[model samples]
Target: MNREGINVDPQGRVAIVLVRARNPLNIGAAARAMSNFGFDDLRVVNDYDVPFAEARSAIDAAPVLAAARQFGSVADAIADCTLVFGTTALGDRRLQHPVELLRDAGPHAQAARMAGGTVAILFGSEKTGLSAEEMSHCHRLLTIPMHRGGVSMNLGQAVAVCLYELARDGAAPRTLPEEARPATAAELARYETLLREVLVTSEYDRRFPGNMGEDALRRLVRRLALQGDDVEVWLGMLRQVLWKLRQ
Candidate 1:
């Protein structure tokens, strides 16, 4: 239930995806938090079913966990989602995607959902946060500021914090028309694959190896911020270019 005056996701366009989460208790905690915030679309990406089954058995998380869907990978989990945000601790790893502070992410994330797009927030496992491969699917990353440099919040706590921030100051939904909506992750992934093929066919990757890595190319494709309608147009153009390059 949304607060009396706040309606962040009136149409149920936001989803929470937990990737590789191993702790059933933490999963229960995350589900409980989702229930508190009126979000029920929970997706779990795990190879095994034990953790999810165990979490769903918890009485407190029954509402959210009972309806949760499990997936094999992040790509499959977020395929229909138009906006994907990954959470991270900003460790010693280099990041290719843009980063936003959690407090400031709510407005931006809400905007995306309001624009007739499904939004997905990805929470990684309890032991380690989102891996580089998992994060490549995200357009941006959000991080909660910590008092201590290396101290990281627990997986469940992190989910609660991020969702709480997202649910605050919500207003009336401002949905866009179908054609004006942003491209979904599956659409973007298709576009990225086609674009990469074009580059490889034209030997651009060979010419500029430094910027043609998987992560870099994925970031570059996302940076374009293509809309729903623009994806096919770009794909067609790239297909033509690739054909010509092959000829």
Candidate 2:
């Protein structure tokens, strides 16, 4: 069963975790940026070459990325984090109910300063954005304001904005235990199977048909490293609308 209540753990190294990111260069770039800000706790949750790209992007900080761990599932990456934040572009959508600001999150950091727990801030893929499932992993959602409408920043840019806010100096950690567990590969794969079937049966693939062959397509979905909760949210939507016929 899922954990009963909300528990926050303050006092730990904040992990700048990326889930299903698209580009190696961007991973390298984010890795470099994190190190610049004194954050070496980088975790890439994807079934791809996270370490390689981090090393390449390290430029001078290549070692930071090189030492970065690649997790096949999000759960493994965040097994120890006491708190988790998910970054989103949907400003004020109430994306994660009762979300906290980067400024407000400082308290938790302050609390954790000595408690020595960990925080994981998750970022999404580049081509589109974070998957519906990925967004659900976070205890709180962090969104950066932009002037222009429909404005979307690259993965590296998004990571930089978030890092500047939470991990920057003069912030305090929280006092709590931990967060919802990350999902297993078996759970994530079930959701992928659902999406894959949706692609095949739903009209999306046929209408905007592209080169999403099984293998290539699997890579795209797998990169997200979605959890069981994430999968359920997407499946719910597909069942309710996307798979339904227009009236």
Candidate 3:
């Protein structure tokens, strides 16, 4: 696979997500890094439009920059991804997800791509990193080891480091069939919404309010790890249950 260069199953299975990145130069550099590693799916979650526009206008900007898609939120940016990884600096913030070192995460990400899953790696802003709410969307978190004195990396540098590690593995075979594809984050989110409604309608929230927080329910559904076909069945069943409760 090294000879073939990033043997992704459906062409583009890896996406780089930037949440609240503010620097135009960093955005351009991030795009350049994606191009360097032969990745093109760049999703930016930024409300401000000027930085994205300026990055695209940069003279040395990569082609991926021109075609990058802008999203209003991290959830929307990563909705189509089947597996989401968030990069963190491991500061004093309390974490709710399991964390993996940067070196170890590449194989897992490559394996996800080989299984026909779209993998998304998210990078937070230049100032503060991913918010607690944004980090909750990830299945697992990845952290780059740093010297004791170093707190974090620059936005563009962090993007480059993560992509470099991922690109180092150029030999994994792309083998999964389309039918075997896992359910996307978008589908899982939709299922979560419906299930939440069912819980509300059935008075489960009132009876068992302990487990009804949005983050808790989201983690609960993700723990199921339903496949594409399974999510449809579950959605149908939940709909029926909701309807019956309403009646």
Candidate 4:
């Protein structure tokens, strides 16, 4: 894929992927990162798109926020792309390409651009990171070199690193497709309400009493990075479960 306009600053195409994220703050942080580095395309796969707005992040990047895309599967997110990469801290194991240095990735990205195909970098959930199944879709793997003995990166930081790397060098800047919009702050709020109703009806409150932490639970639901259809399925399941519980 090595040719021209690949991985250079302000001249290359870019896309972001969030897989099963469980924190809205991280999503907000990512939006801010996009604004800071001039990247707008973001792909999410979860039962609920992360409610980044409620956390008070990604202030000016609202345009990017509005354009975030929802996907039912990772395959859908990176399907048409000419190349795909996954980020991880677990690349010490044997794989086609272990975590490569940003320097190395630069050349690879440019090559893909030369080949004329969309390129994407994938990320996973905060809890367990990307699964082997997800990683299989990537052509390369990048592991941000963390400080010695440092904890793995929070969602925002990881995104900032990638966006910065791609934009700092001036990857060809461009607008993302309609398919790249993430969930808005308002949509997330509605999903949060639905999530709470589901939980409340399912007797989750009885298990925790009056201090059931509805707000916190709502926040948890808001941060999950789910797409519209994904949310529908989750709510349906919750409804069915709650219906049975009431019986």
> Model 3: C-alpha RMSD to truth?
23.2
lDDT of 2 by residue, 169-236 (tens): 53223335666566677766676677766666756777766745767776787677666567778778
TM-score-sorted candidate list, best first: 3, 1, 4, 2
lDDT: the better of candidates 2 and 3: 3
User: What is the C-alpha RMSD, rounded to one decimal, of candidate 1?
Assistant: 23.3
Taking all chains together, the TM-score of candidate 4 against the true structure is 0.60
Q: Which candidate has the highest TM-score of all?
A: 3
Best by lDDT: 3
Displacement of the residue 93 alpha carbon in candidate 3, Å: 0.7
Rank by lDDT (best first): 3, 1, 4, 2
User: Per-residue CA lDDT of candidate 4, range 48-108, in tens?
Assistant: 6445334334545466667888788999989778878888886355566556866568667
Q: Which segments of candidate 2 are over 4 A away from where they belong?
A: 1-12, 50-61, 91-96, 148-150, 171-247
Model 3 error, position 103 (Å): 1.1
Please provide, for model 1 over 1-247, each residue's C-alpha lDDT reduced to its tens digit, 9 standing for 90 to 100: 3556544563378889999999999899898888877778899999988999999887655688899999999999999998999998887889999999988777667788768888899998788889989999999998899986566798888888887777655532343345577899999999989988888888888889998888998899889888988999999999999889888
Candidate number that wins on lDDT, 1 or 4: 1
Worst 10 residues of 1 by lDDT: 169-178
